[model samples]
Target: MSWIRFGRCLVAALLLLGAAGVGSAAVAPLTPDKKVERGGELTASREEFHLVVAKLLKDQGFLDKNNTFKKGTKMHRLFESYLQETLSDPAVMDFLYTSLKENAEHVTDFDAFGKALAGEYAVRGLTRLSESDFQELLRVMNVLADRLPVRDCAGMLRPGSAFDYHWLELLPLDDARVYLRLTKQALVAEITRSPRIAANTKEQTSVAYQALYAEIRRRLAPEKLERFGKIWGKPEAAGDEELCWGYRVLLSGILDLPVEPRRWMLREYANLLRPPQ
Candidate 1:
């Protein structure tokens, strides 16, 4: 699962279901379908790559202009599943940890690494890492490298407290957003569709959600003290007892659950989530 090709596969599988391992989902290279020849090199342009992503989002009705499924849209389970499965799969974690470890050990100069990578292909393509993104990636990897793998998915928070999804193994800064979107959008859709659901619950869910996002922004960054504005476009207001949990039901207070905690995030999110196997 070279970082070189991760996003390419993620987009190609934009519509694929069942499997979502970057390790197995590897694609031809960095970006999308538009092939261009530049100085005898073949690679997709960022413009073309973004175009592909835009179309995929449109066709699938997955994300809104805000880059979230805030319109009550849920893409296929595959996008969210990528994070879910990757975070839960021991094999995937092993591959990721090893890659990040090597990158950290060998690539002291991220800019130099990017420069070297750029020349490897006759041309470069989509999801190709720019020096900035690569630097950010390394920074993220640094944080990840220091933490115990699986991100303590089983212990993200105290038994009585809450956890942030951003700390989850799915690279919360990136794809975990999709997981949140899918999980929430699905919950919203279900509430509307289910006669078994309560209406005030949606209002409560909304309050919790806003509070959750605020807290998510607060806890996830170096500038945790910001009172307003956004971090990565997520609100940094603050949270309350209506704890906003993530990753899955296990951290959703499973042990505290009166029913079998097998999986029951807002009623098991039965349609959207499953306990990590």
Candidate 2:
């Protein structure tokens, strides 16, 4: 339902239509075709699925923990100051304003921002899925939804998972829960384990945070920050890059993220994860 509403935006950032960083590759609009389940119908079973997960964990090493932080850690302080400064940056603010303005000129979906910068027109028929083949069409995405770890062109990064979770929801309730848990764990682990993932996530964390950063700045004053901090931040808030990245594959579908902020995010994430030497 949500996917239909949002138009099943695949890893929007990378799924750009062409190398020129243009529109989405045309995919046939998925229409619900009544898929007939035959008597012999079967998907991979639980044991088989676990074996696959095991291989994913083993081969990808996505479960290996590379960093850890509880609430009120230095990571909190780092995020707080870094975010305030970065959002306050003139160039960054200018980009947000212009991107939003230009986007207003073209399409109407203001809520989705990540790759909208690439251009709004999408062609659906270019995909392998034929018209009316909704069942096989979206399920083809299981391949992506299954890869819990966020590897980059260098490794992996996902700022959000709402999209993936939607796909997972198509599974039986019990199976969805188990698979989602497995994938999320792998997703988080990959971030902490791979410096590449960490860096990418950090970059993603910025723009994604910026969407709300303005409101946070405007509304969350001293007492507001204090009250919220006591509730969540405590002496400090939970400082997990993955929290922001929370498996975003970080959405916003704006243009490919700009350069400087990513560099800063990479450095900050490194500093946060590293011992203060």
lDDT scores in order: 0.29, 0.29
lDDT per residue as tens, model 1, 99-167: 333454454443343323322210111113222322232233234323424424223222322223334
Model 2 lDDT vs. the true structure?
Answer: 0.29
Native-to-model Cα distance after best TM-score fit, residue 38 in candidate 2, in Å: 44
The C-alpha local distance difference test score for the whole of candidate 1 amounts to 0.29
- The TM-score obtained by model 1 is 0.18
Model 2 lDDT tens row, 63-173: 222112233543433323322333333343343344444444453443245233211221121121122121222223333333333322112222221132223323444
Clash counts for all predictions: 5, 29
Q: Please, what is the TM-score per model?
A: 0.18, 0.19
Candidate 2 residue 193 C-alpha distance from true site, Å: 33
Q: Runs in model 1 with CA error above 4 Å?
A: 1-152, 168-174, 193-277
Best by the TM-score measure? 2
